[model samples]
Target chain A: MEPGMISLAGGNPDLAGLPLDALGDAASALIREHGTEVLQYSTGAGIDELRTELTRVMARAGIEADPADLLVTAGSQMALELITAMYCDPGDVVLAEGPSYVGAISTFMGLEAEVSHVPCDADGIVPDALEARIAELRAAGKRVKLLYTIPNFNNPSGITLAADRRPRIAEICREAGIVLVEDDPYGLVRFEGETVPAIRAADPSVIYLGSLSKIFSPGIRIGWVLAPREVRDRLQLLSESTTIHASTLSQHLALTYLRDFDWSGHLDRAIVRYRERAEALLEALPSALPAGSTWTRPSGGFFVWATLPEGASADELFALAAEEGVVFIPGSGFYADGQGERELRFSFSLESPERIREGMTRLARASERYARR
Target chain B: MEPGMISLAGGNPDLAGLPLDALGDAASALIREHGTEVLQYSTGAGIDELRTELTRVMARAGIEADPADLLVTAGSQMALELITAMYCDPGDVVLAEGPSYVGAISTFMGLEAEVSHVPCDADGIVPDALEARIAELRAAGKRVKLLYTIPNFNNPSGITLAADRRPRIAEICREAGIVLVEDDPYGLVRFEGETVPAIRAADPSVIYLGSLSKIFSPGIRIGWVLAPREVRDRLQLLSESTTIHASTLSQHLALTYLRDFDWSGHLDRAIVRYRERAEALLEALPSALPAGSTWTRPSGGFFVWATLPEGASADELFALAAEEGVVFIPGSGFYADGQGERELRFSFSLESPERIREGMTRLARASERYARR
Candidate 1:
């Protein structure tokens, strides 16, 4: 174990690779050009320019949308919160993948909604299992309010839903009259494979969530939700009641960057950097793991989820790894039904290849010590 | 009818008065000095530097609070929404002044909480009426969950609560175990008289809301909630579910502005400007308004609430005013129940004294036209 820990715990992008100069220039230029208009309150829908750009951002995923169909939020998290506030009452059931983003689960729980995990496979949530769960929840007289999924490069899993199944998933949700919330914060971070059609492409009524957190800067906290008119109006009201609007200066900064910078070229550079980090961790894993240990080989995105030996507790491993100066998320935190006890999630988002290699070596040593215990 | 209309309907600050150059410099300096750290995700409590600065900002109000006791929110609007979400359940009662801020009533209603207006006089919500309303609500088996008030320089009323009555309001809430949300966005913008003590001074447990929007800029969306440890933690969770944190870049910009700018001098100038505008509106009112129309003589803040002649309709006057090329909020919009029909709220925040005089003349013409109808 190394004395200084290499944390693979957070899903934060590497600041070294970010377009810092461009962001700074954008903010400065916006304030200079617009004067105090950049410093005033915004319409709850956010600044018009940013929302127009967001439609273009969404169009990249093959989802056709207009500015009127979208509402700017504090981040994609607020988009999720607002959707729940708009649709679900307390005790309403929210079906999500068994192993998913912990933050979303926490958000639903905070809203007093009951989150029930549907079974998931290597290619997102299993369709048949999802359909069965919906029927079971309905049979019990529970209101199935929403079906939330990160169809592309899902957090913790780093797995994208197979493109062929996108329509089926949407159909299932629509048939049940449950709104499907497609949270796609990490979709644009793909290092390999062609861009898959968004679930919103399959169903235009889908509340599609998008963010600049992965590609641009999370500090700006700019994210948008594209939905039907009625849903979009409620989302705007939620923004009004909560944030009023995302920071007006942040929105203008986003607008300036979109208008003036080559974001696509910047994204290409980010992809190259992340792809290298992912490969380094993937290559080191086999040498580090004990027999029967297995992990996903992601083609894109931040995480590489690993399954430990049967009956091995990820919580116990997390404690030991921290003492040994290496850190990752214990996968139990992502599940609503106390599953994922023998799994861990490692993120290669912020770390360099050299740092990831050292962190994996430390993880290997920690596993050996725990196995002996 | 005048050819050029003047808008007194909005609550937006004057662009000419905003510290654009200083704000721009602050933003540029922050990004230049900190690099991408200013462009990253934040903890739910927000950045420490901003919260520390916020504590210093609050100290001027006689609030001796630690940064740990404060949670930085997207804005004071987010603070109000979080308080309602945290304390109230469906069907819970939220009591406020008869003519309070419209935004807040919408927020409580959006959360499915019933908003009821407590009786009010010029000196804000009458303490005796407040205590009686709480008792009445409790007697009816209703949960009197929150007492939401703007303690000084209220939004629609433009009236500060009497100094002696502040303690009584807090005591009433404390005895009933109801949360008191002290929304003080415009308190620090006082252009005349002494700064009154906060209702939070009488009870430290009060969830006091403060914003930089009134004295600084709203574009940054910087606001903070000062509460007890348990309440602060819950507010952080709500922040987590909503905006994640106030924009990290905005936080740094605010910190830089606080650290380097001559804020006291800036505020002094703002006070002087606002006082002139307020006086202009007051001076013009007698000649511009019809007989038996009375208005508040607020010592500070943006609003001047006026009552029209008996049975006069503010909405009817509003329609005529729009036709005559002048505008103000019909007081009906401010009340939770259908009341305040013969009242109007005129803001002196956005226009100059010269423009205000012309607008008042237009309003006078509108009133005469409506009276004949």
Candidate 2:
């Protein structure tokens, strides 16, 4: 199917939200000044300029980090894979949120790690539940290698971890001596919430992932990892044997963009725009959803998670909605056990308010038809 | 140490040889046309236009391939890792030349694969030694997964496989039901010799790896794999879970560079420049080399392989040469068993003729000091 034939299935930024002109200027300047070195093989760690910029960015988030602690990867996905390879042996236990990012689940599974789930609430993974799961796994004699989380505006769930819960969660993992893999691709996205401290700030053992794809562009594939020196060295060595380094040209261009442009202002505009479209979806949901349906009102980021009447299959709804000229990802695909049959996730990030209204209208018709049947 | 402190230690392109002006123009055009998309997350299979262009390029090398059979990776290094993960199980036997690309060797080792070496001559891996090694492993009931080779202008050896050996090597792998991974980063670099058909042409099971770094730019981190459909699909899945894809910005820029620019002409200039540098290094060798020391006269690529006198350590020589303001990679680092202690690899690609001569002179003095010790 054509990618544009969708309202909620795609994980893309609103095209209108990107700072196109600023990026164009940055690219031009990058080529004009550093074209030669930018086109050559760089150090495996990353371009130093980008690293330094990212360090300052992390500092603003309350995480005390240095360029030496960072290894700019192709994306957060690569960071996850490299971490898995470095930490998990075959049959190692990897714990994650019950309904997590499909990419993260797939990455750990591909490395042959046994992925176990920790149930999450409206405010992200339940700290007590996660601790219990870790305890149970230890009692069963399984070595838990790491716990993966997306604390800020997580995929599928679209829920942020509460500020109060962050430290307790970090403390639990630290006490258990398990590394926390914190993937925060959407932390900067502020539709209607106060910023919270990162898990890395609460615990130095946390391996934090950040991406330019969510706030800027997904195509560039620039992401980074902030971790301890030991973990950083292992990731660097593994990356040296993999891609060698993130694209030098991309790094240079990104560094130029960060330096020469007002990124905070750009992100503010993006947040305002996305919030407007998200509000449009929320306003239309009452008439569109079937009886006994419930959905989370996300404060920020891209998705709205919806649950249908009991026994109403999200996969079936997806097919019916597609036939009615709307599309959404079935929530079951996001679960580790593939059991979210009655749920669906709608993304308002890529569509405008008018298109989202049209999509939800079609979705309402499909839901009415399915309920009648 | 500063990257080009002396000479040959790094895998760098000759700055003077790079098509700097053309690259700058290409970068400018790329940003002007696709700045937003370049900064976004790209498809896991890679940018389609770049894949199509690479398909045509591979065809010119006599490997009849489709874009579907190609996967644009971060670099040839990522290709090696993906292939290793796709085909190898722990304890699998992976065969390669005794002295091979250390990066490839390290990747397989990281996967816990038992690496067995096949001896090589000046013209690359000896067919008889390869067959014997395969026979010994098979007799021992070991499952041989793949034979990794750099058939054209191999690293650390600076030797190209003879034209007649291609089919013979292919047939042996075919009959043994083992896959052949043909990594040819330096294949397009023909300084003086006629080009030979790739082993992929002789056997359908052979996997071919190509890089744009040597010819265009390494900073982009664009390389590709041409393999069977099954293997290609597996790599695609692995890539999906790995970095997601190579950098979208780099891929788009590379496509623009290949499609809108004169890549063939650029390559022609690179070959000419490398040839002149290679000749200069060859001419300077006589005055610098000790009696009993010898070097390979490479037809193409960046490195010149030199064997010092028996009982002389290349490690000691490297240290002495560095003291004298010359640097080269001690050849033992390239070997699997640390047996190439008497050899050194001098890269002629990144240095000027004058620098090459000066470096060789320093190396000669170091060699005499080591010989006496």
- Among these predictions, the greatest lDDT belongs to 1
- Candidate 1's DockQ is 0.72
lDDT (Cα, tens digit) per residue for candidate 1, span A3-43: 57888999988666656665666677667767678888878
Per-candidate DockQ values are: 0.72, 0.67
lDDT per residue, candidate 1, B32-94, as tens digits? Answer: 667568888878898887888888888888888889999998888998998898888889999
lDDT of 2 by residue, A42-106 (tens): 89899888999988777656788878999999887899999998888889999988678899988
List candidate 1 stretches off by more than 4 Å.
Answer: A1-3, B1-3
- Stretches off by above 4 angstroms in model 2 are A2-4, B2-4, B15-22
**Against the true structure, whose DockQ is highest?**
1
lDDT of 2 by residue, B1-373 (tens): 7554667777676545555566666656555666656665667888788999997777656788778888989888999999998889999999988677889989999888888888888778888888999999999999899999988888868889999988999988988888899998888888886778889876778999999988888888899999898889889899889888888878877897788878878788878888888888899887676678899998998888898888877888888888888888888778767778988888888777788888878878876787687
Each prediction's TM-score versus the true structure: 0.98, 0.97
RMSD of 1: 1.8
Error of 2 at B121 (Å): 1.3
